[model samples]
Target: METKREKFYMMNSMLCLLKVVEGKRTTVEMRDEKEVTGVIKHVDGYMNISMEDVVFKSLTGKKKFDKFFVNGKTIRYVHIPDEINMKSAMEAKLKEMCTYTASMRVRQEIKDQAWAKLKQKERRAKAEIKKERK
Candidate 1:
C-alpha cells in the first residue's frame, strides 16, 4: 500500500476568528453606518451572524432586540473583546470546533472498514489466481 503524504493546512481565516467570539459579546459595524453590539450566537461559513441581546444603533436612533441577524455582506468591521487574545482564541476555538464530530468519525470508520474488506477480497482473489497457476 502506498501512503499519501498530505500537506498541513492551518484553519486560519476570518470565520475562524469569528468562531472564537461565538457566544461572546462583540460589536459589528455595518456598511450602512449602523452598529450592533450584542452576544454573538452563531456565525456561519458565509460570515452571516446571529446575535442575542442586540442593541442596534444608527444615526436615526437606537433600537433594542432580543435577537438579530446580520448579513455577512453588510458587515464593515467586527470588534471582539480586548480580553480575548487573537492567537490564544484562535487556537482554543480551532481545537474545540475543527475536530471531526462523533457522527463524522463513525462514518469515516465505516468507510475505512469497507475499503479494508475490499482490499482483503482482492488479495484473496490474487492468491487464488497464483494457486491456479501453480
Candidate 2:
C-alpha cells in the first residue's frame, strides 16, 4: 500500500512534468535511458511522444533509433527532469502581458482625457453664446 505522502509526491511530480511539457521546450529521458533532447512535438493516446529533430518518422513508418538507447526498451515515455530552467521564457511572457496591460491603460487614459477636453470645450462654447445673447 502506498502512503499518502508517496501519493502526494507522485501527483506533484506528474503535475510538474505536465507543466514542463506545456510550458516550454524540454528534453526527456526515456525508460530505455535514451536522453532525447528536443522540444516535445506531440503526445499520443498511449502517451507516446514525438520529439522534434531527434526522433524521426521513417519512410517505413518506424522510429529510427539514435546512438544511445540506454536500456534497450526501445522508446519508453519521455521523462522531463524535476527542475527545468524556464526563467527567461517566464520573464518574456510576463513582460509581454505587462506591456499589453500598460498599452490598454494608456489608451483608456488618452480616451478619457480627450472626452473630458471635448466636454469642457462644448461647455465653454455654450457659455460664450449665452453671454452674447444677454
Candidate 3:
C-alpha cells in the first residue's frame, strides 16, 4: 500500500512558542520597542500570555513586576532559547492545529446542512399555503 504525505503549516506560532517555553525564561518584544523578560505563567488559545516575575526593559531602564499579562495582538516577537529541543514542540503544535481544523470543518458542514434544511422547510410551507389558497 502506498500512502500520501500531507503538508502541514504552523497555524499559530505564538501557541507553539508558549508550549515550548512554558516555565522557561522568555523575552517578549512589543511593537512599541519595549521588551519584557519573565517566566511564562500561562498562555491561552488566543496567544495571550501571562508571565511571572517580569522585568520590563527599554532603552531608559528596567522595571520589575511580580506578574504581568500581555495581549496577544501587541506582541512583535518572542525570543526562544537555542538550547530547547524543537522536535517535540513541532509535533504537539501539528496535533493541535489538526484538531482545530477538523473541528472547524465539522462545524461548517453542520451549519451548511442546517441552512439547507431550513430553506427546504420554508419552501414546503409555502407550497402548502398555495394549495390551501387554491
C-alpha TM-score for every candidate: 0.70, 0.40, 0.58
**Tens-digit lDDT string for candidate 3 (1-134):** 11122122124343665666778888999988999999997766666789999999988999999999999889998888777767777677768767977997899999999999999999999999999999
How far off is residue 15 in model 2, in Å? 13
Give the local distance difference test score of model 3: 0.78
Q: What is the C-alpha lDDT of each candidate?
A: 0.82, 0.52, 0.78
Q: 1-134, model 2: which lDDT tens digit per residue?
A: 33455334433343224333643355555554445655565443223455554543333443544322222235555554456555544455445545765897899999999999999999999999999999
Q: How accurate is candidate 1 locally (lDDT)?
A: 0.82
Off by over 4 Å in 3: 1-15, 22-24, 28-35, 41-52, 57-61, 66-84
* Comparison by lDDT, 1 against 2, better one: 1
Best model per lDDT: 1
For residue 128, model 3's alpha carbon misses the true position, in angstroms, by: 1.3
Candidate 2, lDDT over the whole model? 0.52
lDDT for residue 80 in candidate 3, whole number 0-100: 81
Better of 1 and 2 by TM-score: 1
What clash count does candidate 2 reach?
0
